[model samples]
Target: MKVFIPLLLGSFIFIGGLKEGFVFLFSLLFLLSLVAMIIGLIRPSLLKFSNRISAMKVLFPVFLASFLIVLITTDPVEEPRTDQETVQEDAVEQKETEETENAEEQSEEQKNKNEDENAAESKNKDNREEIHNEEKENANEESDSSSVNKQEEKQQNNTENKNDSKTLDEKESDPSNDESTNESTDSESDKRPSNETKGTTATVTRIVDGDTIGINLNGTIESVRLLLVDTPETVHPSLPVQAFGPEASSFAKKTLSGKKVQVEYDGPKRDKYGRLLAYLWVDGKNFNEMLLREGLARLAYVYDPPYTHMSSFTKAQSEAVNAKRGIWSIEGYVQSDGFNAVESETETKQSNNSSTASTETKTSGSSAYNGPYNPQGKDRNCGDFDRQKNAQAFFEAAGGPEQDPHRLDRDGDGAVCESLS
Candidate 1:
């Protein structure tokens, strides 16, 4: 500890007139002083420099004063140093200070740079969101304009259709003026036959299904089915009849009983049923489109050319399903029927609670259309009715009750099926 003070004083003087030998001797003495201080601290009795403790304390103070005086007085007056070594030390210290200031400045600049970058990025993100919103707004405006135009066009068409219908009705109702009206209609039709195929020429001979009809083409009768649409059948003939089958058939009959239609073939001339599959034109409008717009049919084709009207068809179907129109109104189209054990547990609880239970229970939970009154029997308790759409479709395709490929009810309990019922 004593050496620290003396060494600092000597270092300043060492740069002056002090020789290397003198500096070395002074440094050695300072080192010895430190060793003595350490030894005194560790083992006070081992130190032999002073006798009495009072004398030693007083000696230390005196020695410290004398040492400071010697350092102050003995420094020989000499010329200031102009050596390369002195210049290098000053330069090194100045460079060090400059480096420290530069580091601090750099740290502050980096913090500001990060803040600016983040602000820019946040602004850019907000701009992108605003641009997206603007695009959406434009699209909505276009859609509204298109819808308004479509409505106006539809109203105009309806008016024209009603007028044409009335004209034909008037001509047919009055047999007296029928020849003159027919001659005028023929003249008008003849003028446009080359440009448009007149549907009135073809006479419908027989109705095949809701969508298909047999028409006298030239001389031979050709079976024509409307394209891009499907309708429920009284009996698939290819598949099977489903629920509301007769209603679907009746609706079709009422709509097209004696209507004239122009055919536009899209794909193969005929189906496996020898039916001409094409888009039908009625009153200059596509009947296939009418079925979809009326929510009476679903767009059935999924692949290839059918995709032309797929977007519009899908949109219409989505609207119908969302509105729960027609088949979509029927529950259990794609829902699941869970485990039987869980269902049985619930039924057992219900049975216990109910009083006056019937003796001829007949597996009351079973949905079997067996009895006379319950032709579509216990199956009516369709907790799983929501799943019937797909199930019914599959069953109809595989030949329902009459010719089912897999006898669903293996035990022959007068229940043709049981899996989902």
Candidate 2:
């Protein structure tokens, strides 16, 4: 009976165990029943519940029959999608595919357009260069012919003077002609000034900033950054406006604006920004060297080999510095270094997670922070912060110290200046 009960339970489990959740639960119950029945059979003296055992034997067949009936009636195949749903899914997939193809086509068309424009520009530039070369050749030929004509004319005049020598001798060296020639020379001198010849004439269109100007050289306008000079940065993109930056620019305007100047290139014709780098000569003076000499500018040391006017300009700048001129007059202007300050801030941010929790290096000695440093003092009481990000930002800005004026992360914890849990 025990062997037969286990075989029956196994058959019932095989039939209905694959149906769903409840089928597995019933299978587990049948397995336990089979185990109990075997134990009861092995030791009839152990199991005292005779009535319950007989009831289980009577219920097993009925339960197995019921399980078989339910398994036969249940459907196993998955439900099919409706026609409308299937159509909608197909439309979405097709739309996505078309969009991808359209994007690819647009990108290819843009690339082709860019290539065509570049080729057209190159061809135009080549044509312009060829035209310029041809014009230069024609001009050389004309000048050569004109010089030959002038030489012939001078020779003819000499021959005519020789032929007229006899008439002049008869006239007794004509005092009237001599007086007329002297009068003509005096009149010509009166019309022409002694300071007539100026250098390469360029009309100054605009002053870009201190030490920089825009001028029409020949016919084309070009930007000129003065060589051997760097004024206080007024129009600099990355620097704060300096106290004397305006004064320097005003000085440049008063000195050189609207004047015709001469450009003299040193080593390189153009700087990296394509500005013509030159010593601007205005009114018989080198304006580039003048800027430093007058203390309106500083002699920057960023020049290359064969530095055009390095020593002279450096001496000028040293004199300017000692005299406390222009930008140097401002107490902290010369001392203020935004670069080191920014670098210190960056380092503080990166080293925030260190075990010390404060900045790896103090801000005073390394950078331009200049904030009072007292690491052992009371909490500097930078106000409460809700978010850790804002606190960390302020902490970095406040010189990144655990015990500085703006206290952040007082407990020397990695989290600085915030109570955000």
Candidate 3:
């Protein structure tokens, strides 16, 4: 019977795909059965059939609990990235690189062409000057001969041609004279690749976060990650929302949402995530620098080459940090490793007290959402019955389910203000 039982169980395990969880559960059961059988043999009087039944009743519940825990904690299998998607991404990157290189080559070729034209014009002018001088010498030495007169006429003709050539060159070089045509040319010059393409203007379709935004690039909508700035994480899948993240998101939405912006490429056109990397210019100001100056963002060190505004951005961040603005006001808000806001014991106690008051208000059937939600300030929390913007604010201030007995953080990644997030 024992031999047949194991054989039957082995067949069942194989049919179950022999998964690790199944194998572990089967092994535990098999060992327990063996131990029970041995104990019964060694002390038959102590472990009777009735005793065995009682023991199984206890063991079954423990076994079921263990199985449940394993099911809940085990990581699911991840799907593999498709080959087709990888190839497509690679092709796009290659095409963008080629276009940038072509622009640079074209600019260089244009410069060389202008230089050659100038050299040719100057050489022809020099030759005309030498001929005019020779004609003058002939006029001074000759006694009003017809050949001398013809030479003077030739000199006058050369002077007229030189003057006309100089005038045409000046007109071609000077664009300031024709205001209407200049305005039109200036508008198109944004996209034209000269020394560098002027910042291309685009309409902001959406603000993804404080440091990320969506802009309509020509006809296509592309994500643009801001250069030299990193705000707190409010929408990260793996990590919980950091303190002041919502404030940053809110600021970005208010300032940049649905606005037209100029996107200027600094280093590479696209980042590794296939998002366009650019500096955003709004109302003739650098938005990234403004965020730093306002103490809304920290300086990120993930810099690539040709970081033109790095020094200025670094200086702005220094000023913001020294001023103790926004997130910097919170204790232990480190710059290098994101916002690690460390609350002191007193602060924690105060926060807990506030949370308690808010909780009591909710439990006592008093409405916490009774007042107007003014989202203008930087450091607004959930306990402030003055304003409750959304569930995210409630969730963050409530400190989630563990801290927030109110269950405000539904998904529990510590994020609130869903509209801004």
Best by lDDT: 3
Which prediction has the highest TM-score against the true structure?
3
Q: Which residue pairs in candidate 2 collide?
A: none
RMSD of 1: 21.8
Model 3, residue 350: distance off in Å is 13
Between 2 and 3, whose TM-score is larger? 3
Per-candidate alpha-carbon RMSD to the true structure:
21.8, 33.5, 47.5
> Taking the tens digit of each residue's C-alpha lDDT, what string does model 1 give over 326-403?
544555331121111221343335433321132122224224332222222222232333454443443333334433
lDDT of 3 at 298: 78
TM-score, one value per model: 0.31, 0.33, 0.37
Order of the predicted models by lDDT, top scorer first: 3, 2, 1
Ranking by TM-score: 3, 2, 1
lDDT of 3 at 339: 57
| lDDT tens digits by residue: candidate 3, 36-112 | 65565555446564565565655556566665656664568789879998899999999999999999999999999
> Residue 264 in candidate 3 has what lDDT?
81
TM-score attained by model 1: 0.31
What TM-score does prediction 3 earn?
Answer: 0.37
**How big is the positional error of residue 210 in model 2, measured in Å on the Cα after superposition?**
0.2
lDDT tens digits, residues 299-341, model 2?
5434344554554544455556567765455443342111112
